[model samples]
Target: MKKRSWFAVLSLALVVALVFTVAAGCSKPSKQPTIDKIKKRGVLKVGVKADVLGFGFMNPATKQYEGLEVDIAKRIAKDLLGDSKKVEFTAVTGKTRMGVLDNGEIDMVIATFTITEDRKKLVDFSPVYHVDGIQFLVKKDSGITGLKDTDKKTIGVAKGSDTQDRLAEQAAKLNIKPQFASFETYPEILAALQSGRVQVFATDGSVLKYYESQDKNTVILPDKYSSEEYGVATKKGNDDLRDFVAKVINNMVSSGDLAALKRTWGLGK
Candidate 1:
């Protein structure tokens, strides 16, 4: 009877030990690294422009995204997750991208997000990936050739974009006060331009090109100004992710892969 009691106690201890061993094996640490979280989730989330063709546009017929920025996001995913298609893209506009990033709805933003001192306070930016300039799109028959001709004309710019402030500063320098109208998206600005609700549609020159291609009557002004340095944006305090993104961008720039993407998208200047 004593021997049977000893065996029962031993078996109970062994079962307890096995339970603890299994629990320890399955347990995760209190805090996991950002990369590990992404790996476990099996998808890298990125915000990109849905309307800006060549930079980031969603092809309606194919229901897939294809653009330079989209490719960049995919490249990042490929390096981190070992598969380019492991990325999920969320469409964002100038007015909404930052909000989404701040809310943790996206891991990062690859939209044509221009780096500015004011924006730096909100999020960290990767190295300048692309350089662009603000330009105008107008009907060829509008008789508006340049900033000098835009005095008192209504200019359409995206809400929460740097274009408005830059345009105002330029207008002040030229001593020509152009009235400004703000829209939520690039497409809305283009539509306002077509409907004559605003005399000019203004944003980054590359973005204007896509709109111009869509409308045969519209022409982009040659007066490109306000150097807009585009960068990838990561959430504030996300140093690891930001550093990784910077490394990837540096590699692309060095290997001429970025230039190749630019040429493929007709973004090469």
Candidate 2:
């Protein structure tokens, strides 16, 4: 009976030891930093605009994304994954960009997103990579040369952008009240303007230039409303990624690479 009991005790000890060995081997590693996660995945996911020509646009002919923002995302991917082509693009508008970043659909957003105090509450922003001003795109025949002539006129803007607020603030200074019509995308706003549904389409000057290029009938007003500082946005609490993005932007600015990129896309001015 003693011998049998000894054997049973030895077997139970071995079983517990084997279970512990397997558990240790199967335990997950500690949480990985965002950069490491990207490296492991072998691709960086970026949210960008598909319609803004100079910044982020999908070439209809090539059916591929290209623009200043797309290049920047590729550069980041190269830094993180050792291959610029290891980046995936997800077309995003002002309204959907933040949602995708928040839901983990993309690692970051380089979608001509303006940095603002209110937005800083939800997502961390890298340093300003580009600065543009609000402007109006009006039909050549509309006779609207500037904000002074926009009183009581309807201006179209993107639904989630700050362009409307900027216009309101500027118009208040001029004692004018222009009606606003918001749309999901810049193309829709331009369409509304073409249909005479809205007399003006207001957005960043760089973006307005693209629409003006597409339609010779449209002209961007010379009056600059407000300066918008564009930044790369990362999920809130992802300081590591944000800092790395900031470093890349700072390097670009210092090396004149950002300006060169702008010139490549016809946004030099």
Candidate 3:
């Protein structure tokens, strides 16, 4: 009976040792960082505009995405993983990109996102990737030359957009009250502008240029009211991802890749 009892005690000690060995081998020392998580997944998820030509747009004919912002996102994936196609593009609007980025739904955002003091409080922005300003789009035949002419006239702006704020400031400064037509999407704004429902379609110059390019009758007015600084965005406190974004953008700018991309998309001088 004493020998049997001793043998049972030895087996229990051996089992405990084996269990601890396995646990130690299986456990991680700490949680994985954001970069590691992206690399492991083998795909970088990016948020980009689905409309807003020249910046981020999906070509319906080819059923493919193309634009300066799309190129930036793909370049980031290529530089990081050595493959550009290893990325997932999520269509995001001006308002929705922030929520997904804040919730970690996307790895990064290259969606013509403007960098502002208020936005900086919610999420981190990379160094200025591009600079654009608010401009106006009007039909070529329309007599409206600038903001001064719009006295009680209707102007179209995207809902939940930075342009809305700029428009408010402009109204306050000019001391002119213009009716506002708030649309949910850029296409809707374009439609409204084309239909003459609104006398002015105001947004980023790049976007306004796109609208002008599509039809000769549509003219992009020269009134650039506000300077907007565009930046890549990441979740707040995501220093690692922010650093990665900055490095990619810096290299692209130095190598002239960004310039080439903009030229291809018909943006940037």
Candidate 4:
């Protein structure tokens, strides 16, 4: 009886050891961060502009976001999430773009955000998808051909845009005092110009073209204000996500999709 009891005790110990060994070998560590989470969520949260005309804007008639930037976001969603319609548009402005990205409110920003060194410190930018220059829009009859002509006239600019700073620097060079009136968005600036509240509105040439298409009475002056490049903005440290986005943009650029979209939106030659 003693021998049998000892044999049973040894058998139980062997079983417990085997079970632990198997558990340890089979256990998996937690998953690392991946684009898979975004795919699983079934939505690509894209930050965009709601009133930037050709780049990103909402069509009230259809209640859908449409434009070059919107198309780019849709392509990214289709590539990463397998559905072009899986994008949720979050309207963003220059002042709020970085804050919204840092707060994780959106996965990426496809707004017409200019890539600058200061901005690069806060977010990662995909490859330059579009190259443009700042320009001015004035009444077709304003007789203002360039900033040089606006010696003492009022100029409308968005509060947080690079245009505001560029205009200031240009005014200093010209030794002119510009009546600087700030608005929250490009549309607001455009409204101010159309209403004769401001003599000029400064922004990217592509954006000016968009506004001109909507209202033929407006004209973009044949003057280059400042050079700028537009790119996709992702939170800093997301190297994987940033690379993925960059790859998509590069592919689009090579495959003629970018050019096609630009032409479709009346932004290309």
Candidate 5:
């Protein structure tokens, strides 16, 4: 009788212990330190571009950021935290993306960040989320075919953009020095070109797509270079976080989430 009662109490205690353990496991993600941190904080901080329309932009209508990068970040947030709304977005630019990521102002950057040898030195990159390339945006009938035709003509690119370096490299190959006009943002460069302040908007084709769609008079010069592999970025030596992000990206690609997003944004190859 007494022995049966003792066994019943012991069984109850063990069942309670098991329940708490399972609950703890549910509340906290196991393994990766970065994943654990994110779970503890209950939110993911992501850096994204605010000016580029298709890639990332703050929609004036909703007062919320929207676009491919934003969609990617939201999907990742949903996977990590079980809710897409568990994300906080910070606007980053060509000049500030790496700086803000390095400063820990954001846990990850999905801001059309092109993977490059130089950028690899500063931070780690997840598997490529999008494949883009650099191209020249010129006016219709402007007679600019490629970099060889620049001939010291003014080319506009965002300040701190790798486009400047790419243009210089092309200039070296062509034996011509091209003049460059720099703006602080991608939209500003487009504005400069539209207003005839610069003859060309030379940057990523993914970015120029917006203006090309809006204005029929503009044309992409039909020359593509610098095969840009856009990746999510994390701080240097953050291999754990990088790996986790890479897994999320892989899942997104596999589950057709990313492909659906590309269609939603009207992003084509």
Candidate 6:
């Protein structure tokens, strides 16, 4: 009888030991770095454009930023932070966008940033969200059909934009010395072209179409300077964040939300 009691007690002790071990293993802390800063701050800082039409800009009457890119950023904030209203918009220009992202001024950039090998070296990009091509915008009466006809004309482009690089490369290839007039924003470039400050405007074909829609007298040239893919940009070395953003974007695309947003914002190709 004593042996039986001893055995029972020993078995109980072993069970307790096993339970303790399992509990310890289960209670181990997660290794992921804390994302509490965003929650505690009660805001998700997002970089967006204030001048680029259809992509990011403010509604004059409502004084709210509304655009396809802005909507995507808001959706991301909603998924991660539980409320779309938590997004705080920061106006960023092409020249300052990457710098602001690298300095941690914003958590992510959804400002029509193009994905390129050179930009990828400084920041991580989510999956290709939109496809575009560089094209030329000219006056309807200019009779300029393509880049080949744009000899010695003043061309307008946003400084620090991918279009600027494409224009430089195209000029180099064609051995054309086209004069360039750099603008601070897309609106300025459009204005410069419309006001005759520059004879031509070079940018993504989609953006050129947006401009042409606003002003019926503008024409987009048929020749494409280069193809580009747009993506969400985050600070470098944030692989986990990049993966999360990419998953959300892919889901958005698959579920037709991205297409709907593009149509609503008049960004559809």
In order, how many clashes per candidate? 0, 0, 0, 0, 0, 0
Pairs clashing in candidate 6? none
Clashing pairs in 5: none
Task: Record all residue pairs in model 3 with backbone atoms less than 3 Å apart, i.e. clashing.
Answer: none
* Model 3 worst lDDT run, 10 consecutive residues: 24-33
TM, every model: 0.87, 0.87, 0.84, 0.82, 0.83, 0.81
Best by lDDT: 1
Model 1 residue runs over 4 Å out of place are 1-32
Candidate 5 per-residue lDDT, tens place, 1-269, comes to 99999999999999999999978754553344777788899999999998778778998899999999998888889988999999999999988887788766789999888899998888899988899888999899788888888887899988767888887897888899888888888778778888888888988988888778777889987788688899999987667788888999999889888888898988855
**Every candidate's lDDT:** 0.91, 0.91, 0.85, 0.87, 0.86, 0.84
Per-residue lDDT tens digits for candidate 3, residues 97-151, read 8878766789888888889999889888988878989999988888999888887
Local accuracy of candidate 6 as per-residue lDDT tens digits, 1-269 = 99999999999999999999978864565455424566778788999988667888887888999898899999988887899998999999888898788767888898878999999888899998888888888889988777766678888888778776688777878887778888887778888988889989898887777688778899888888887898999877666668778988999999999999989987777
Distance (Å) between predicted and true CA of 238, model 2? Answer: 0.9
Identify the runs in model 3 with alpha carbons over 4 angstroms from their true place.
1-31
Ten-residue stretch with the least lDDT total in model 4: 25-34
Give the clashing pairs for model 2.
none
Off by over 4 Å in 5: 1-32, 214-216
Q: Model 2: per-residue lDDT, tens digit, 33-83?
A: 888888788889999999988789999999999999999999988877789
Residue lDDT tens for model 4, 228-252? 9999999876777899999999999
Model 4 ranges off by over 4 Å: 1-34, 213-217
